[model samples]
Target: MIQLNTKRQFVYFIAVVLVIILGLASRKYSNFLPTFLAENAGDTLWAMMVYFGFRLLFVGKRILTAVSLSFLFSFGIEFSQLYQADWINQLRATILGALILGKGFLLVDLIRYTVGIVLAAFLDKLSLKYNN
Candidate 1:
């Protein structure tokens, strides 16, 4: 098991919060960024946030396990967009809903999510290696 002590878990939680803030900022101020980056940053950060969130919760899991779970959850959320109902749409219209469920589905999002989770896994491994 990949166990992190209380202090490390708290740190992971803080990182998740910071990433969420940055992801939101990226969306809000996207017009200021270059077009390519502006378009993709939010999606990528969304996956990264999921990875960190999983890391925070599954502190005893391996990095690859966390990454895999994050990818699956992100993909599931993306796929959930295909279902459209008034009630669900209304929920999707809300801020939290939009943030979690997303507005639509894109094949490229799967790739972006994979990239984000892979990067997160790499960073996780690096952190473990350096800290040990």
Candidate 2:
């Protein structure tokens, strides 16, 4: 694996921060995001895009591994919501909230995970070709 330089590290840091911010923003204020959030299918599909896009931008892991991690993380978070953390749950009910804090668990979320991971993998390859 190539060791990231200072610039790359900075980019990575920013990328990670953006990912977190977007994730949080999506959770806390879904209405502020895109038109897709108002629609269930669009929201799920966009979530997959964000998940995969983050993985693509991240440089610390192998493509497949990174994508898999993203998929697992998404799945875990959605599944964990079944426990119903009041504050988190309430937040998820919002437009952005729903994006991050999904409304409980749905089998379709697994499909979203798969789509996200695959997109991440594809984007990772694209990044390698163009950015590496």
Candidate 3:
């Protein structure tokens, strides 16, 4: 049976919150950042947030599992953009939906999500190795 590590889950939850704050800040004050970085950072951070969220929920799972699930979820949301119903688009127009669902599909966003998940997984593994 898998054990629940409350400490680790709490840490992951905190990290997710931090990432969300950073992501929102990046979007709000993007003018401060270079155009290239600002354009991609929010999406990348969103992927990281997803990764940490999965980590928080599945505390004892392997990092690969969490990362894979994050990627699948992120990619699913991105591809879902292909469907543009009036109701769905209206939802996407809101702050929460805009943040989660995004405005449109971009192939580059997939690459950003992949990079974010891989980097998060690598860092997660490193943290686990060193903490132990």
Candidate that scores best on lDDT: 3
* Candidate 3 wrongly placed segments (more than 4 Å): 1-5
TM-scores, each model vs. reference: 0.92, 0.56, 0.94
Please tell me which model should have the higher TM-score, number 1 or number 2.
1
**Model 3 lDDT tens row, 57-132:** 8888989889889989999999999999999999999999998899899999999999888878888888898988
Instruction: Name the TM-score of candidate 2.
Output: 0.56
lDDT of 1 by residue, 9-53 (tens): 976887788889988999899999999889888898889889999
Root-mean-square deviation of candidate 3: 3.1
Better of 1 and 3 by TM-score: 3
Q: Go through the candidates in order and give the C-alpha RMSD of each one to the true structure.
A: 3.2, 5.9, 3.1
Order of candidates by lDDT, top first?
3, 1, 2
Full-model lDDT, candidate 2: 0.61
Per-residue lDDT of 1-132 in model 2, one digit per residue for the tens?
A: 535565645554455455556555565676766766533444345445555445445646666666666766777877887888677777887976775666778787677667645754575577668876
TM-score of 3: 0.94
Clashing pairs in 2: 26-96, 27-96, 27-97, 29-96, 30-95, 30-96, 92-97
Location of the lowest summed lDDT over 10 successive residues in candidate 3: 1-10
Instruction: Sort the candidates on TM-score, descending order.
Output: 3, 1, 2
